[model samples]
Target chain A: MEDEPSSRPAGRPRDPGVAARVLTAVQDLLITNGYAGTTIAAVAQAAGTGKAAVYRRWSGKADLVVAAVLALNAPVSVPDTGSLRDDLVECAMHYARGDERATRVLASLLSEIGHDPQLFDAANRAIGRPPVAALVAVIEQWVRRGAISADVPTELIAGIIPTAAFGSVTLRQRTLDTQTISDLVDHVLLPALTGAHGSSTQLL
Target chain B: MEDEPSSRPAGRPRDPGVAARVLTAVQDLLITNGYAGTTIAAVAQAAGTGKAAVYRRWSGKADLVVAAVLALNAPVSVPDTGSLRDDLVECAMHYARGDERATRVLASLLSEIGHDPQLFDAANRAIGRPPVAALVAVIEQWVRRGAISADVPTELIAGIIPTAAFGSVTLRQRTLDTQTISDLVDHVLLPALTGAHGSSTQLL
Candidate 1:
């Protein structure tokens, strides 16, 4: 999953503060106008940047879409709450809330990307893996400290945690509230992480 | 989340068989072409029917897409292997092999549906809840059979299995091979399902 073949060139920053503003504009455009309606000129105007600046950074609509997704991909720093339960619960909330708008953009971007694997590489490099890697890093530390187990692959376990959150958003049309996320983390996610087996759970 | 406020349907079924054929064509096209490339004309061509026939069945392309997704959305048919290890491991392989093109299509479709609430009901009815509910049913049965704990919510436990498989496919570009799925089931997924706390798994 990790072997993406994109080398970052010395253009501007992949995402600068101005670029973030542009992506925020793109996100707003995405939510309001839908992907079909979003235009480079509209994004440039919204961000108060020049068209040249936008083009200088991203190659075309697909490239800009990926950049916007990357800007949208940034998850806030997860807190080390000393307990896995606390950390995950907090992470889920932060995850669910941070940029509902941005995440929505991903659905649109992925829609476009699925037909074209070339876009997948760009999306993976510019947008996809950073946040996932962050969570995996936390789980890796836990494994190192004997907090979690070495028997489990750090990447796989860490990967499942974020998957629940994104899948909730990806799978359904609901707003993906905090309580729903918390419920997932506390009951389903933790036990799965611990691998506790005895009896089946009651329906929720 | 449960209450979709504006879920009025356009029409009811006329010829379910024809609709089924159209939907099956849609699934094949989606598996083959993806959301962006799928068209009414193409679907009609593939199904050996006219475009009017498809329109009579669904409100639009999105509605048609919903049907295709639901075609593969059978509930969690977790195998009764008489052991959690065997059941979960088998479940992972099923996840890996069963209609992967549909799986990828859903990954993209899911995100797009988040942006369009009008299709929410159609998506849920056609594609969403059956599989998840099935997974929940199977997990609950397992728990009642003394295979898992009644303490966990079935919804939460249900979330984990797919969270691993879908998450793996969507986030990382890995082959969902049988052996890989087996490893995910036996080592990662099964362990997560059981509980990660114990030093070693004692249950079968």
Candidate 2:
């Protein structure tokens, strides 16, 4: 790792494991105490690091919480299964099967996030944009192949699965099951993308 | 007003005005202090009433807040405009233009609601069910008219606009504008319902 010569205090080299420990501490504190309750001092204490070490990595609580939450949701690989339906289904399942602790932390953060603009922006950047980007990439491939229309609002269409998954956890207190994911892809995403309903018998 | 004869303590009949004041106070405190911060005693003080008055009406904080939120979102009348498109658009806009205070309260409650089973159930009944019920009613009307397939997951189709509107306010920090709502209806909702794309030119 490159040293931040200017920012680093002239001393012995930093502990290589501090960052991981601090991040893990942040998640634990967040899940237990929530956004308002989780403090840098508490995180540092839990991580067995100094407050200065935590601050050196992240600016403050918002930054730390956002980083912790982002880490909790490890990015799903964008599937290139040659079928948009399959890709979307895989994407939905990935979100539906997200870590329970992450869901709890996010649920706790939702309130604080609304009140704090900095936290909201940090969350939107760290948590919100990635899946949409992945979905957009998948949809664009179909558009290029002429299998889907060029005029599809790729961004809006891309938001459906992620938004649904979010609502499921944060509001409904459940994850979307496999059958529900398939139904969403075939009925909502597929129909919206292809302009054709899936399984006419299912529709009838 | 029908008195809760069993629950109400023997005293002068309950004041009709106290319920309204308590509810209004609950909204104000929720918006200002968030779920964890707002207490029943605080709400009583803000409303210039006794805690017993607040308790007599609702069991606790969750009930009071849920009632207040429900009151804030005055039920949208289900439109039967003789056109499914018009009806759906009307429903979407109704949610898009929801009370800002209600949105803030909800954003605050989201975290706490996940942890509290009673709050979750009360919120689902008070806040969540009404709009979905309204949308389901409208879609069922169309289904009866044979304009849309009977087998359409009316419940899922009904959920889209409201979910989008909720995500817009809670996550995106803005209401869905007319153009975005229209595009959602034309591109997503309508297609999913009718199995046909809207506007050939728009599709291209």
Candidate 3:
């Protein structure tokens, strides 16, 4: 692949803000007009940048859309609250109260995921994996602390957390409130994680 | 308002199979070309029916798509197997391993839901409401039997079950299998419903 103009810097310095502007433009187009309507030319025009500048960042629409989606979900730091339950709640909250724009982008992306392997992998890596990984880390910590049972499937539990949170958002067509998030953790994840056993029973 | 020809005896009786044919055509277009690509003209052409026939059944694209999605889901009769756990498992399976075409249709509909109120309401009523209702019915049955505590927020629990099932399918980019469905019920739903206590204590 040809080196991106940003890396070479042959002429005047590339605007540092160009990347953010492009991503923002993509988000606006994605939310308002959807995936089919958004395009590189439109994004460049919206961002007030040359098409070359947009290309310097992402290869094409799917890559740019993927980057925009990932930007919507800026890396959530894993919660290390000393207890698995609290940490899991923190992770759930990240998704439960996540950017509405991201949810819109995710819906658009999910529609095409079955048909586009590249888009699917990009989304799975950027949008899907982080929260699950955070949950896994928290559950692993709990396992070490002897709070979670040995037989509990940490991976499945991790996957379920984000799924449940975002699923509600998708179904309701609205962002989840604090009460709903609390219910999700209290009623779903914590019970699944603890298997209704000892030590972690206090949340109930 | 002019009565639809199908409802009246105008000329030849409207073919009894027109509705199914049109719904199937919509599903095909939706799966292959997505929501943006599928159109009324194209659906009518594919279904080998006139535009009037399609319009006679549905008001427009949103209504047509909504009906097609509902058709894919058909009606899942709530299973009553003498235990709340079996009933919940049955409900989960309806979603976890639902028709692939329905999943595709749902993805397409979900993408545009934010912008289209007609599509949103149609989808909410057709695809989103039914499973939650079934789950609520099952949970209510258990509550009556005294198997599940009356204090449980059956509505919230009901929402979570399908949310978790559909969410997993969305995340994985594929339908869940039989074992995964069982695990979801045995490990996730049952534990959450019973709060990991009593007869459902096997998982812990």
Highest lDDT, which number?
Answer: 2
Clashing pairs in 2: none
Tens digits of per-residue lDDT for model 3 on B1-204? 122355566685667787888889998998778888899999988988778888877899888887887676556577798867778777877765556555656666666666677666766666777777888889888888887778666787687556655665565566766666667677766777786522334322
Native contacts retained by candidate 1: 0.60
What is the lDDT, from 0 to 100, of the residue A103 in candidate 3?
Answer: 66
Sort by TM-score, top down from the best: 2, 3, 1
Model 3 CA lDDT for position A173: 64
Off by more than 4 A, model 2: A1-11, A69-73, A100-103, A199-204, B1-11, B55-59, B66-73, B199-204
Winning candidate number (TM-score): 2
- Candidate 2's C-alpha lDDT? 0.75
For residues A1-204, what per-residue lDDT tens digits would candidate 1 score against the true structure?
111113546663444566677778887887667676799989888887767767766888777776676655554565687766666565556556645554556555544554567656666654456656766666666667676666665565555555665666566633466666666655545544555432223212
The DockQ of predicted model 2 stands at 0.61
Writing each residue's lDDT as its tens digit, candidate 1 over B1-204 gives: 111123325664344466677777787776566666689999888877777777766888977776676666665565776766555555545566656554666665654665667555655654445555656666676788886767666665555655666655665534366665554555554444565333223332
Interface RMSD of each: 4.0, 1.5, 2.9
Clashing pairs in 3: none
What would the C-alpha RMSD of candidate 2 be, to one decimal place? Answer: 5.0
